[model samples]
Target chain A: MSMSPYSFRLAAQSLHREKWINLLSVLTIASGLLVISVALLVAYNVNAATGKLPEKFALTVYLNDNLGREKIDALIGALKKKQSVAQVRFIPKDEAMKELKTMLKNANYVFEGLDENPLPDSLEIRLKREAVSPEEVKKLTGDIGRMQGVAEIDYGEKFLAALHSVKSGVRTVGLSIITIIVAGIIFVCYSTVKILFYRRTEEIETFKLLGATRAFIRAPFIIEGGVIGMAGGLISLMSVYVLYYVVLTRMSSVVPLLSNILFPLDLFLLLPLSGLLLGVAGAVIAVGRLRY
Target chain B: MIQFSNVTKDYENQTALRDISFVIEKGEMAFITGPSGSGKTTLLKLIYSAEKPDRGNISVAGWDLDQLKASSIPYLRRNIGVVFQDFRLLGNRNVFDNVAMALRIRGMGEREIRTKVFETLKSVNLRHKSDSYPKGLSGGEQQRVVIARAMVADPTVLLADEPTGNLDPDTAESVMRTFKDINARGTTMLIATHNRELYRNTGRKVIRLEGGTLVGVGPG
Candidate 1:
């Protein structure tokens, strides 16, 4: 027997009959989804900010003042050959002095007494983003400092470590919040569906007596839960988008970096789809154990 | 066809049926007449598989009740229509929907359900009230709606429990005539009633019960 049409009609009728309670359930689900979505947005932006810090990270390898040009070139070639190294640029001592002078143009008086440039010729080594961890940089620097012509190696180890910690902490807290909120939404749906089932006990009894099968009896309730969840998801999607638009646009002028925060439009679309699946799951659990 | 042999049923506090046995052949229309708590309803329930027998055997339309699984009870009920004294109708639904429910449960298409529901409502003289809700109908009208719902599926056996207990004399007579018309069309019927007037000149079999025991089984 094809029960789809009949069940759909029955479900539609039920939703109309119990609009008030169903509306409340949808709003409750939407609220939970909104909280999770906002947390996701904050975590996404934080991760993005922390992720960009590695692009500018580089190690300065100062060479011996008496090293020959060929030896410096050989050291640059060797550093470039390393698996973690992305690029190596040799800055001549004279060019470094000129760059330093431009940077301190307003304080030129501090450099007037120097007889000769104190800075040594250095190779700036940019590493792969994936190799920017404090431990990896420390190992690489230790290896490079032992080279014959290498004088010193410097990379900000403490800052890199702190950035990694912040990124991981954001991820852990974001996932935990989302999990609890998703479970809360499912419980809201479960309780609503169960209450609706009990309220319609008389009608269900009549259906049972009229030879309706278990599937026939459960179809409408299941559909109701799905519809409620989907609606809640749609509402939350709109709410989160509005929040993103208002807050981000207004705050972008005050904090220009806020404009770099990704909206993740593709992933946000899963809100309603996930809501629908979770709603169906909640309804299934609610009705599965009932005496039908 | 319906047959019961030495069927016994007990509730938590009291025995509802004890060592009861009877048979109503195909196309037969019979009555079970007894006082309150005489196990008349329990007998009907047993035939419909609403309650299992404590001991003994029951076969209806060639299906053995003892061997029937719980999942198959709905199929058994599809072939047996039942009416209650309280007129168990969905008040939120109109008479058309109420009658259509039985056909819908059978997964019949909407077009066929509409045709069958209208035909059954016409049979019970309720076609004009097809759009009216149960709450708007009188007691007798509500009972006829229930009868239409029960009959729309064209079941082989029909059971009624005090179908006219809540009706006035004229309405009650009219409802009985409808039942007679259904039975005349070759459907077996077993009606449970305490009112002897419902069976007094009908010339049909009447089984009597007293305190869950079969007191007599003979023609009314």
Candidate 2:
């Protein structure tokens, strides 16, 4: 049977009558969805930022202090011949010192009394896309370490591996937690609808006697559950937007990196859609459990 | 039209109807008079498929309940009206909604449902009480509202169980008069009641039962 206007009216009446229960359900769903949204936002930004880092990955090849310019040219030529080696740039001793001072900034006073520029000339070897992964980078570094004029090789391998591990861990844990919260939202909707159904047993029985199909009796409860979920979804969207705004405005001032991350505008639609699905699923479960 | 061929029903600890056999012609009015636990309510329940028989078969308005599918039960029920002793009307809904429920479930147009519900309410003398809730109406008025709800869809058969069990003689008679008026319009009726005065001198077919067994069947 088709759903009538009375079905919506019935849902509205029930929602109004049980305001406290509906409110509690909405709050629970909203809080859960908020957590999900925040997690998704963080995960997406971290992945996006890290995904860009591999393209900038570089291997620093330090040359021997006493080596002649010709030896350095030979090493650069060797690096350029390697597979997946995109480009090589030479950083002279003075330029390295200049970059170091820039990195140290106010701490450059420690190097003021040094008799000479202790930094060695280095080759900055950039990798192609295929060599950007940890394994390929490690192999390249090992090959460069055995070369003649290369006194040392530093690719920040440990740091990149740690970042990769952290990203993987966050993705795995975040997905598990989001799944659990979605289930919780569904349970909240189910329990609320079940409670409402029991409270309206008399009305349900009357509907049956009046020749209402099983679908007719179930449609209103489902609609009511969906309404509750949508309310929760709406509240969650608002909470997340407000949270993002606060983070953007206040927190970014103290931690400038926070300014780089943003909540996707499409989440405004996706989060509510998720909540609606959860609510409908909960209603289906609650109504399916009835004897009718 | 209704038929029960050697139908028997049982609960967990006792039988509700035993080897009951009967047939009601189309447009006829009959009374099921019996003592408490004598299967009067159980028999009426069979007519509407509320309770199925453990043995034998039943047919109501040409739907063979013995082979009735669960999916088809609603359609079968749409053609058979039922009135409970407790006057099962939705307390949260106004009388108009309560009576219009039958049409609403079937997705009838609002305009048609409104006119039909109003007319049905008038027939039960509850037109003025259309906006009143069930709690605001008296016992008899609530029962009349239930009757209006049952009759609003113009069901082919009406089965009522102890419809006046909680009413005084005057109110009970008034409720019966509404049933009689609906029945006069060619709707078959089967009423279950304990009050012997209800069936006496009525010149209607009476099926008497004692201890879940049919004891007598004759004109009252």
Fnat, 2 decimals, each candidate: 0.73, 0.61
TM-score of 1: 0.92
lDDT of 2 by residue, B1-220 (tens): 8998999999988998899998889999999988898988888777777788899899999999989987788899899988888777887789999888889988898999999999999888899999999999988889888889888999999988898887889989888998899899999999998888878999999999999999988899
TM-score of predicted structure 2, chain A: 0.75
Please list, in the order the candidates appear, how each scores on TM-score for chain B only: 0.98, 0.97
Candidate 1 wrongly placed segments (more than 4 Å): A1-3, A64-78, A109-117, A142-151, A249-262
Interface RMSD of every predicted model, in angstroms: 0.7, 1.1
Model 2: per-residue Cα lDDT over A136-170, one tens digit each: 78887888899998899888888879878888888
State the lDDT of candidate 1 residue by residue for A220-279, as single tens digits.
888888999989999999999988887779988999877777787754678899889889
Per-prediction DockQ comes to 0.77, 0.63
Off by over 4 Å in 2: A60-124, A128-131, A139-154, B167-171
